[model samples]
Each structure stands twice: as structure tokens, then as C-alpha cells.
Target: MLSKASTARVVIDLDVPGPAISRHLYGHFAEHLGRCIYGGFYVGEDSELPNEGGIRLDVVEALRALAIPNLRWPGGCFADEYHWQDGIGPKADRPSMVNTHWGNVEENNHFGTHEFLALCELLGAEPYVNGNVGSGTVREMSEWVEYLTRDGDSPMVRLRKANGRDEPWRVPFWGIGNEAWGCGGNQRAEAYADLARQYATFLKDHGDNKLYKIAAGAGDDDLRWTEALLKAVSCLGCGREPKNIFQAISFHYYTVAGTWEHKGSATDFGLDDYYRTIAKAQDIERVIRAHSSLMDAYDPERKIGLVLDEWGTWWDVEPGTNPGFLYQQNAMRDALVASVHFDVFHRHAERLVMANIAQTVNVLQAMLLTDADSGALVRTPTYHVFEMNKGHHDAVSVPVHVIERPEAYAVDDHAMELVSASASVKDGRGLVSLSNLDPEAGLEVILDLRGVEVQGVVGRLLTASSPQAHNTPASLGAVAPVELPVNPASRGTLAVTLPPHSFATVTLTL
Candidate 1:
């Protein structure tokens, strides 16, 4: 490490190709909790906000720009208790229910299956539906699948026709349950593993729409759930060919700077708090690698994929907001968290096929925040990070070896790398996403481009005056990406300086 300037050497090996970074890895999640489903994605037809079929147009347009691959809906803990039938009928006639897991608020069942699918269609994203396993029966789960994907005449088909849709919607991902350890069902790992097998058995595929059944696995460092599920489903001694009970296993990890009892405030925090959050965010790489190692012991062929369905920073709600809403502001700190996460996700793309950030809008680390009364929309700092890294979608991953780097940012004993990076190539073009995790010092990075011919380089940077800097409806552009000048390659290497608490992406003309 250079004392004058925190310097690093990142080797982007173009010849040795890695896994295809699934566009699905850049997915977002929305639940029925708080404003995420209601005001977040769907306003009523009579709303003053411009909408189609009660889905917000501005939000759809903003997300469409990001080219988000898939959207997980009606969940977190809400899926286990949600009764699909009650939400399917006419809006005026649909039954109202208490969202017990979130706030004790009554939901009018306005945004049902059709509404969610419509939102996905508008955004050009696939739909991932989390099914109810805690309180729903096998028949109920089976019928829901048939209703959404069956083509010909049947009970579910007839029911779908009566509700006004003739053709089936293509739903590629289906979650068997969510977080069975706690809010989902408080069941032991062994118990939930058996239940997952039963539920997965009934989730049949219809027409040409194949369902990638994902079983709810574990959270945090709990590896027993994954082992239990793998053990229960393993057909090692059956003499016949091994059959996967589920297509994928899921896990959830959230970066809380403080404990769950008192997650630090979103907009108010010290530099130590910022570094602590970054340290926590960096833990995701370890978690993913750990989970991937476990999955390998069971399925060496790599037939199963790991779905990080819920992630992102979980700060305390903004003042004067309902605690159950989980509504928090997004800051430059959150942007770095996202940037570091993507770098880690790229490294594990071979086993990690898809990941969805906790909640999409007006929820924890949301991309956009909406004003229900004024119809105002503001894109958060996290949104810019996603937009800036859009070039990596469906792109082939490449090795980013940080041989020379700055010292880790240490908060007391916990230390996190000061620099994080990932690279990819697609169609003769290449992209390098870099983040300087240090809050007080800039880092000079030299891209050691190898095994590929480089032509030119352009860059854009997202940063703030301070780590706590955030966006509001009043100051929407307080934190956004700005053009960064980059000199052409010098001896097969591209050099750029990253500002503190910032994320930058350099596009390479290869």
C-alpha cells in the first residue's frame, strides 16, 4: 500500500472466463408490507397519480431503465399468511385481511396476482411468487400454480377465466416458503425440510412454463437448515438417478449497523457507524461462500442454485414513520453497501444464480420513495448504483484480483477491505465496477487489464460529501452519478482514482 495515495492493482483477466452473471442477480423484491405494494407499486385506479391498472407509471419507467430481471412479490413473512383466493376476485368484492406480521393494518386486497403480474409485465421483468406454507394446504398451493400457468380447461383454468384472463402468464420462479425458522413457521430445520418436500411435490409445472421451485433455506450463519434440507432431499442410496426436490435454496442476510433491538438511524450516524455498516455488508461474501460450500457437499454437479432473496441495509425507520413499515432512507453509505455486494455476487455467480434486494420502493434501502399525497417520486442513491452497473447484466464475469491494496478500514477490532471491485465482458465491451469503502481517504486504482485488447475507457461516479448524505423529495439529486474523466489505456492498463465513500464504473471498449 502506498502511503501518499491508497493504491491498488486490480487484474481483470479476460482470457479466463467466469460464470455468466445472471441478470436475475440484479433483481428487486417487493412485499405486501407497508407502502411497498400499495403506494410503492400500486395506487388505486382513482389515485391522482398517473397509473395503468392502478400500477404507478413513473416507478415502472424508472425500474424499466434498470432492466431489472425478476421481481419477488407478496412476501418476506406476508406470503406464509396470504390467502391467494381472497385477493383474486373483484376489487370491491375482495375480502379485507389484517396483515398480522407487519403492522396491524387492514389490506383491501387490491394488488392481487393479476396486479403483480401486470407490474412485472410493465417493467419487462419475470415474476417470482412466494407461496404460503405456514398456513396453506397442498391443494391451495397447487391450485394457485395451476391458476397462474395452466392453459386448457380445468378447475383452476375455469376459475382464471371467470376472473377475466384466458391465457396463462409465464412465471419462472416459485418460492415454496419464506424463513421457516421464525415468522414463516417457527419449525425446526428437520421439520421444515419435510414440509418443504411435501409442498414442492404439489407445485406442478403447467404448459411450457417451467417453475424453478426454490425452498426457503436459512438466514444469517445458520447452516443447519441448509444441511437438514439437503439431507432430507438427498437420494444417495436410492440406486436410481438423483432427482432434485427443489431447483434452488434461498437465504436472507441484512446489514444492521446496530443490533435488531436498536438498528441505527438511517440519516443520523457517526463515521464509526458508517464503517460498521460497511463491515457488516462485507460479511455477505463470507455468508454466500459458506452457503455455497454447503450446497457443494450435497450437490457436486451444481444443479441447485443459491437465491439471496432478501438483502440490503436495515436501518431504523425515519422519524414519524410506522415502525412496521420498515421504511428507511437510502444514503451514499447504502450505495457503497450495494456496490460491494455486487462485486461479491459476481465472484460467486457460478453457484449464486439470483438475488433480490429486500424491498423495492419506500421500504428498506429502496430505489425510489413516493409521496402518496403529493404524487412526487424521488430516486434514491441506491437507484443510481443499480443504473450505473447495468452494463454487467447478462455479461460474462471475469476475475478481479486485487493484489496491491490499501489497509482495511478498522472499526475497533472489525476490519473491512478499503476497496471492492468486479469486472465483466460482453460483446467486445467490458465493464469494471469499483468502490472505495473508506470514508475519509480516496484510493488510486490501476486496472491491470490482461489477455484482452483495450481501446478506450469512460467512467461515471456516485459519491457524496459525507457517508450519511441522502436524498429527499425536496433534494432529489443530492446524491447521483456524475461523469468522471478517464484517460485511455496506458500499456494494457486503465487507471482511475475513486473518491471516498463512492462507487464508479468504467466502461472499456475492448
Candidate 2:
């Protein structure tokens, strides 16, 4: 933990570069829950808002600014119940179903495969489709892949052509299921692993499109589930080369300030609750390290990948909203949570391939919030964090060593570090992201940029007067970024003072 005035020394080794930080790590997720789909991204063909093919043009424009690399679609849990066939064809003639998983709301099937793909096209992002394993057949799963990626004549290809698409769309990522231990299906890990193998076996590649099949994996702290999956999939002692049954394994972890039944409020949190939230957010590093170790045990060469498909802060929905809608306010704390996660993510880039923040809009820790009545869009504080860290995408990860730091604060009996940061280099320039977790005090960070010639450094800072400060429709620029000055320290070091509960990114001209 850091005091009101503390200096932390961090060393960045530019020469000892780690793995390339996959651009897919900065991905977004759009599900069929609440306004995230209906009033969030899609406003119908007749809305007053600027739209292209019924997709919100402003949302597209805002996300494109972040250079969002990939998008996971059709679920958090909805993918299991979604039948791809029902969502395709004409919109008016499409059937409706009750969304039993979320709020028991009626799904009118307006946004489907074609609409989602169109949205991805508009945003210039790759689509990662999650298949239905809880209620659909293997043949159904196989044909959906064929319908989306297969070229030339086939049963599903003909059906896709008849439905209006003349050519196949390129889809690279496919998920077998979601949360098999809970909402996806209450199956054991071994049972789900066998099913994953069977389902992935038929996900055929067509033309130039190859699929990277990801199996729905363990929940947070479910090490036995991960070990069970490794045992079911590993072919080490079979005396033959191992086959890629699934390209990656996915797990989910959400930072919550309280228990599941009583998750703390999004905006009205006290100082103790805030510190507890930070401690919970930092715990993801332990989860990632544990999973990575198990993966290394099964495949020493690191052939398989680990995907944190679902992550972010989960708070009690704003008062008066539907509990299942999961609508919450974004604050500076959410931004710090994101910054801490990215710093941890940069450290594990070797095995961590991709991650999608729990949602993109109108849900828990959303980037954008939409007003259904007025069709107004508001960018959240979390959005600015993604924008500031965009330079990290696909850049070589440079190890950040904390030579000296503040004493860890005790939050709910857990040690919480106040200063967190990560560095990456690309195209002869370097980007260093820094975050101060203190809510009331500022900290001076000294950067020891090693193995690189220092030329110049420019910085952008994101913070507000209060930790609870956020952006609303009336005040969209409330918590945005401003120019931050980087000063020349003694020797070849660079110095910058980060305000409490703030995030900053410095560009190094090397």
C-alpha cells in the first residue's frame, strides 16, 4: 500500500522482451442480455440515431477508435440456448423465445448471425462465435460452422446462400460452450471435456478459414476442474503425437466487492469496500498463474493456450433496474481495476492468448451506456482505459521490475499493492502504462528505461476530482484523459506523478 506521498521505482528492460501481447487481449464481448444487444448496439432500422444496417453508427465509431481486435458474440450464457437457425432468415418471420437465463425477457430474435457479422465488419473486428453445447446437437454445431465458413456447394452452404449470403464469412474463433459447471450445463469437468472433444472434432475448416476451437474451462479457483480437463485431453503417454482437440481452454473471473448474493453497489461504495475491490481485482494474477502452471505441466512446450474469455468487475445493478439486466455505473475504480488486469495480463502473455471484458455496453463494467428513451450514448470511464492502452496491442512485452515500492495495505486481510504498471515496445517506440490504486493520495513513479536510448516522452493522464466521478449522458467528458507531463529525473530515469485512482500511458520515442 502507498501513503499519501510515496515514490515507487520501476525498471523496464527493453532488451529482454517477453512474448508479444496479443491484440486479441483487448477484445470486447456483446451478448443478447438486456440493452447490450437491443437498445445498446442495435436500434432497429427506423431509429432516429445514426445507424448503418440497423447497427448503431456511433457505437461503431467509438469502438473503432480503440482499434478493437476481436469480438465474442451471442452470449455469456445465452449461447447455449441460442439456435443459430432461429436467428437467421427474415426478421419479421423470425420466432421469439423467452430468455430464461436473464430476466425471463422475450428475445425477439432481431439481432442474429448476419447482424452480428455486419456489426463486426463495420467495426473491423474479428468475430468469435460461441456454440450451443447445452441444448444443441453435435451435427447442429458442425453445420453452423459450415454455414458460416464453408465455401462452395454443401447442404449448409446452400442454405446460407438461400438466406442471402452469397459467400462464406471468415470466422477464426469458436467456443464449444460456456460455464459448463453452472448455467451452461451442470456437468462435471470430465464430462464436459469429453463433450468438448466430440464437439470440436466436427468443427471443420473450409477454404482459407481455419477454426481455433476453445473449450469452456474452469471457474475461478477451480484447479481440480483444470486438472480434470488436462487429464481428459492430454495424450502424452499414448506413444503418439498429441492432437489439437481444442486450441485453447477458457476460464472466467470477476472482481466483486462482496458476496454473490450481496455484491456491493457500483457507485455508492465506501473506502473499505473500494479497497476490498482492489484486492479482489489483484487476485486474478493468482488465478492466471495457477492455471498457467497446470497447463505447463500437461504441455511443457506450451502448445496449448489459456483464454480468460470473461472478466471484469461485477457489482449490484443500479437501484430500480432489473436485477438480471446487470446495468451498473462505471467509475474511476473500474478503470483502475482494468489497468491492474492489463498489467497482470502483460506479465502472462506467453500462455494467455485472449480476454474479453465481461461486456462492452449496458452491462456490468460496460464501456458504453445507451439511453433507450432518447437513444443517447455515453462512454464510460472504462472506455478511456482501453483507449489509452491501445498502443499495447501486439507490442512486445517488456518486463517491469519493481525495485522499490510501498508497503502492501491490508484490505480484508489481503495485501494490496498501490502502484501497478506494465511496459511494451513496438515500431522503435515504447509504451508504458501506470496506475495508482490510492484513492486519496498521489504517487511519484520513477521509470528506469533500460537497454533503450531515451529520446522524448509524452504522456496522457485520466483521472477526476473524486474516485466516484463518472460520465453520464449529460456529462460525457467528465472522466476523460488529459495531457500529462513527464519530467526528466536524475540520471537517465523518467518521472511522472499519477493522481490517486488514475491511469496514465507514456509514449517513449526510442
Candidate 3:
């Protein structure tokens, strides 16, 4: 009864050359879109929930617990339409508008610059603001940076004083624009690159926080856009290395539930869709490979970081929630995707310096989703995945090759696999984490270590009875991580049965 599928043989050697991996890739995104702000992050001043200056204490505590290193802010497309001015000074006086792109819901400028930066402070996260390069003026973008960072006397600085923030808050990381090829204003790569240069130069040095100025990169798999940006730098007659002009080149890829237009529901989708999403999530590796190779040809020193600022599973919104809100129920499939993603990032940690799961809370693939009306918190499947992979964050990534029969599966226009794993040696230990996709079939494989010898395996597994299971607020334990055994059945190999569909981490003592 699929016994071979459960036989896992692995080998290890103590001494091996390792790759130095970056730590900052364990990052997250916080947008002003929909409930990502209001109900998700900030519960307002008068609510029964414990809060600080309108931010939820529970949310803050949870984010801190996640150890989120960096956080991108204020928008997806909202930044392009945002005037940082509207979010400063007074909340009652802040202007409001209908978020035309997302549900036409009213966006009261209440949760403005101060509220966001404050949230960042509570979480100890560096702020990455996306500027309005498409719709707003050069002066507006520049002033916003000055207001947040400049200590010297200036109108913007004075405005900061008037707004009750005496000390300058260093908003370090900045994106020159959002999706210039799309919502941030659809323009030719050449046109947007020139525009990016202008806004970046204008938002120049503010003594404390030197603006990072990340340029909008190619959409998923669109390499021409990246190439065009590399060539278009000369357009800014006052030239610099395109790499030097921007600290990072931002690329975005969302694992859509179906097609982008009608992304399928987060829950209730069939097994085919689940396998397809996992397969697509695996493509992020290829996306980074293609983009990194192009950038390498241009700047081999790897000066410019590839920032995957916007990513995560984008399934259909939950029923009754505003579709514009982009809320979706999380599942073990998402947890598996998260585990797979950590492995992908661990593989390319040097070049891919930072990445943010599409959002932090209550929106697409959130970590902590709250039922605001009920004052409840449901840890998403993605949350469990993050918790499982936390060990790989700042560790040295080691390569682990998979050799097995039940590997790659061909489906429709995409291909998926039953297994994905990454090994790393950090601090004083070796870590091997994996996610198996075949729900009905457990996996049997060998992890061969050429010369390195590891003593034992300490592992944990997040598994469920079925692929379609989920955790509602009332019933939270539909799926969860359980500790696995440490005993090795063989001398030079490891044998363990992976659950139907699960995410597990195996630690080897060197």
C-alpha cells in the first residue's frame, strides 16, 4: 500500500562547502488597500480591542512574533494615487475618496503617514514606501521624504512639527513607482524608466534616511521590460548605473487562483487547482533566475537587489467580504506553498534580498486574519508555514537534491511536483525542510549527503486529513503542525513517512 512512498533514505557528511545566504528575505507587505489597514491592522481608537493610537495591540504583538524583517507600505496601486500630504497632520481633517480600483469603497485618509510609520515602529520594521510617480508630482514625492526624515528647517520639516512629530522618522526604503506597466499607470518601459529617474532624483538625500528608490521591474516572466529599463538609463542625461540609480529592482508575481481576472475562490476549489497553484508558486524560482541572469550580465557584482515586493496566493475573495478587499480563506495548500517558497528563496537568497507575501493581514494570503466584527483571530495556513520555516531565515543555505520516482507531474499548461526541499547549515546546526504536494500519497526518497555526517533529525509536520480542509474561527484545528520522530531507521540514511499533503522541517545535528 504505497509503502515504498513512505521509505525515506538520506545521507549526510559533516564537512561541506556552503553558500552564504542573506537574512532579509523574510519580509512582509502592508498595503492601505481594503481591510489590510482598517479592520486588519488598525481597529480604531474607540474599539473594545486593546489598541495604541488606533493600531491593534494584538496585531502588533502577532507581527512582532513573526519576526518580520522589512515591510512595504501604503499601497499596491494606492501609492500611485496617494498624496502623502492627505495622510499627515490631522486625521479628522484628512480628505476621503472612493477607491475606484478596489470596490469603490470610501477611503478616509484617517490611517495616514503617521499611523503607518507608527505601526512600523511597533513592529520594528523598516518602512518601504511606494511613491506616486504616475499621478503625483515630483515635488510631492520629494517633500514626503523630507517631511518624514529631514531634521533641518524647511516647510516640509515645519509641517512635520505642526503635525506633532518632533523627531524625524527615517523611512529608509522607497519604491520610485508601483506597477508602471499597469495600475501605477501603464506606460512603455522606456517612458516609465525616465519617469522613475526624475522622481528618484527629486526625492534625494534627507540627512537621516537616504531614500532607496526601487524602480518598478518587469511583470512576471516579462524579461523585455527589465532589459528596456537597463538600456533606458541614458534617457536621464545625467547618467548613473541603472543599478546605482536604484537600490533594488522590484518584480511582482501573484499566484492567481485561476486566471487574473477571475481568480478562483480560496476555498472550495478542486484538487487540480490546488496542484496547479503549487506548480505556479514553484515558477517564482524560474522568474528570479531569468531576471537575475539579465541583471548579472548588466552588473555582475550583484549590486542591485531583486525585490519581490508583491507576492502570495491570490485566490477569490471570501464570501460576504468586499471583493475589492481581496480577502481569501487560507489552507494547507497555502501552507505548503509557503514552505515551498522558503525553499525557493533559500536557493537564491543572495540575489533575492527581500520579499513580501502579498499582504500582512485580512487581505490576500495574510498571516493573521481577524474577524473584526467578532473580535477573533484565525492563524492562516500560510501563518503555520511561516512559523515552520522561521529557522531558515538568517541561515546559510545548503543545497539538497531530490532523487525519486514520484516527482514532477504534468497537468494542463503547467507542471507540479510531489516534493520540494531546501537544506541549510546555520549557527551550529543543519536544517532540511520540505513540503510534499500529493495529498493521497506520502513520499519516499533519499537525502544523500556526499561526505557530511549529521547525528539525528528533529522535525515537525503541518498536515491535515484531506486537501480541502480549513480552519474557521469556531473550528481552528482543522489542520496544524505535529512533532515528528527523531530516530533514524538506517545508519547512512533517514526514513520517515510524510503525510498526505504537508509541510515539515527536519533538523540534523552536525
Candidate 4:
């Protein structure tokens, strides 16, 4: 319990470098489901909107602006049902198939391996391809890798050159399967581990391209899955020397408003719903800690990393949208969620290698929302959070000690702090991100920089009058970021006040 008059003291040690934040930690995900690919990214060159080779220019620019390090593609569940052969060679000759996992919509195979690699090149992001392991065979998965990375004279290499790219594309990350416990065949942990080992064995290196294979890990806090998979992989040698086959294990956790079937409304929620969502989002820290602890039992050397491949808030679909589309609006609540997640990731930078928020556009927690009919694109509140926190990317984590913490907001025993924060330093500059989740009460954070020297400070704040405040094509800039005033410190300590339900990033020159 914290006294109401007590101000939070954040002590940042500037000299210590806790961990080097992986640039890949700030990653994004794009799936073939809904308009995430067709209208959200690819609008075709002939469309009235500005595009390059059928890909929307505005979307590309927005992603580039974020300096997104890596992007996972092809599916969430759709990856399992997808076949690589149907989406390559010629556009006219490519086959069309019904996306059974999604809305039963027909996929024309317009965007395939080539398109995805090209898009990654455009965005300067590494392409993390999810191989089809549920229905496709091992040969299909192996050849897809060969087709993309084989620079030598091979049959697949010839096809790639015939398709237009003479030079091979580098694919650094690959997923054996997604959601193996559910949409990815529903196999138990042992069975999925067997499948992962087999697929990883065949996913070879072509030329200078080395694949970092990620096995499908537990969902939420299922430590059994982690234990079973790691135990199974450890015994791969079978009475001989043991071998760890995976470079990383992936965990998927989505923050749903309530139950899966009746997830509450996206923009029509009250304070209870808002606090419940924050509590749900904070549960991710528990998931990461528990999973990492399980990994430690088998991977004590810490060679293997935890990849949060699919994460973000999943609310009920917007009204009138296709039920399977999974489209939802981003609000001020989402900004707080992003801030909290980013802080958690920074705090756990040692074991957490990468995290890709689910569905980057017009889909779950999307940074950019697109309107096909009106040709309108609006950056959401989450986008501002990402942009503001970009300074922390690749920065060394600074040890932050929070004293006199704010009391938790409790609702039925589920509690979270009113203020969340993380700090980092890079290039002689200190960066700190703080989120005040209180809906009505502002928090004044006192920075204890007794031994550290700071020349100047600048800040940016993102907040709105209502938690449901969001950006729409009709009402753009409704919940954007604004510069915050940073007063000079007194007695060798800096102070900044955060408004209720706001996320702020302060940068200090050292």
C-alpha cells in the first residue's frame, strides 16, 4: 500500500549497462488474414492511391518511419493452410485458394514469397517466414527456403531468377509452426517438438543465409508445454550426446478484454473494462517470467531465446465488419498497453530476443488503419507509442529502482500499478518511458539523478480525454502525441508530472 501523498522515486544508474536491447525486439507481424495484405498493404499499381508495385506507399512509409526491425509474415493460423506453390512464378498463372482459417475468403495468390521479400526489402526489415507444417510436406517447406535463399545454380534458384530476382534474398528467421497447440494441428507438446526437430533439420543454410529456427512454444502461462517441448528436444540424441535444435522458442499471448467468445467492445468500454484490460495485459510479464524459468531448467546457458511472436490486445470486431476480419480500433487504452509491454520487454531484455505485435494493419492492435473506399490512412495511438519509444531501441538498459510505488488499482483481486516505467541509455543520452494508467489522478515522478549529469531534457506525451478516444478516418488526429514541458531539475533531481491515462517518454542529454 502506498500513501496518496508519496511521490514515486525512479533511481536510474547511468554507469551500469544491464543488457543491450535487441533491435529485433521492436518487431511487427503481418498476416494474410483480412485486409492486412490486400487492401492494407497491397492496393495494386493501377489503383488511384499512391503505390509502388501494388503495395501502398503510405503504408510502406509509415512502417519505414517506425524503423521496424523485423516482420513475421504469411499467417497466424493461415500459415498452416498456405501452400508456397500456389503463390509464385506468374501472377496470371498463380492459383487461387479459399482461406479456410480466415473468413473463407478467396486468396488470389497475388502476394506471395516474392512480394513479401520485396516488401521486406522496401521496409529494410528482416523477413521471418512461417513455414506451412500442418498440411504441407517437408519437401514443400525445404524447397521454399531453397527458392528464397539459393544463389547457386539449382532448379529452385532458376525459378527465382526466371521470376525476376537474380540475387537471392536473405531470410534470417523462420518459424516451424504457429500455435501448434491449436490452429497449427493441435498436437501435444511432445508431438510438436518432434515435428519442430524434423522441420528444423531440413531448413538448411543457402549461401550466406543462415536460418534461425523458432519452435512453437506455450500459449499464455502453460509451463507444461515449455517443459514438455524442452525435455523432448533435449533427448533428440537418444542415448547419445543431447542436442538443442531450436535457436528460440516462440510464445503467443494476446490481451483479450474478457472471454474469447464474447470479448468486450473495443471503444464502448467503461473504466472497469479499461482496468480489466490493463490487468490482462500485465499478465504477460507473468507469462514471460514463468516461461523463462521453465527454459532455464533445460537451457541454463541461456543460448536459447524467448520470442513473443504474437502479442497485442484483441477486442471484439468492429460493428458491420466481417466477423473473421479481426479488425478493431486502437484507443488510449491501447497506448497504455503498448507502454507497459515495452517496459516489460526492456526489463527482460536478456531472455526476450524478439516480440512481434499481431497483425500490423487494419487488424489487431494495428499501428496504421486504412480505408479502402476513401483512401484514408490514420496512425493510431499505439503507433505514437512505438514512435516515441524508438529511442530505446538498441539502447543499453539502465538500472531503474522505483521507490514509493503507487498503489495498485484493484478489481476483484486483479491489481496493477497506476504508474509503469523503464529507462535506458545510448550515445550519451538517457531515455525513460513512463505510463500513468490512472484514469483521473495525475502522478508526479521524481527522478533521483544524484550521481548522473544531465544537460537538457525533452518529452512527449500521449493522452486523451476519454479512454476510448481513437483516431478515425473521419476524425483524424483525435488521440495523437503532443510535446510535454520538462522543467529544470532542482537539487540535482529532475521532476516530471504525468497526466492521468497518459504515456510519456523523456530524453535527457548527458
lDDT tens string, model 1, 1-510? Answer: 335548888888987788999999999999998899888899879988889999999999999999989999899899999999998978899999999988889999989999999899999999999999999888999999999999999999999999999999999999998999999999999999898899888899898999999999899878888888878766433434235679999999999989999999988999888888999999998899998888787777778889999999998898999999988899899999999999999999999999999879999989999976677898999999999999999999999899989877677677789999999999989999999888998888888899988777789999999988988878889999899877644688877878888899999988
TM-score winner between 3 and 4, please give it: 4
Error of 4 at 453 (Å): 0.9
Kindly give the number of clashing pairs for every candidate: 0, 3, 12, 0
Give the runs in model 1 whose Cα sits over 4 Å from its true position: 1-5, 235-242
| Candidate 4 lDDT over residue span 395-425, tens digit each | 9998888886678878668787787889998
Which whole-number lDDT from 0 to 100 does residue 15 have in model 4? 76
Per-residue lDDT of candidate 2, residues 5-33 (tens digit) = 48799999988889999999998999998
Over 4 Å off in model 3, which ranges? 5-19, 233-243, 445-457
Per-model RMSD to reference: 1.6, 1.7, 2.7, 2.2
Model 3 gets an lDDT of 0.79
What do the candidate models score in CA lDDT, each in turn?
A: 0.90, 0.91, 0.79, 0.87
Ranking by lDDT: 2, 1, 4, 3
Worst 10 residues of 2 by lDDT: 234-243
| Candidate 3 lDDT by residue in tens digits, 284-403 | 899999998887776666667888888888887888778778888888878877887788888888788888888888888889888866888888878878776777767877657665
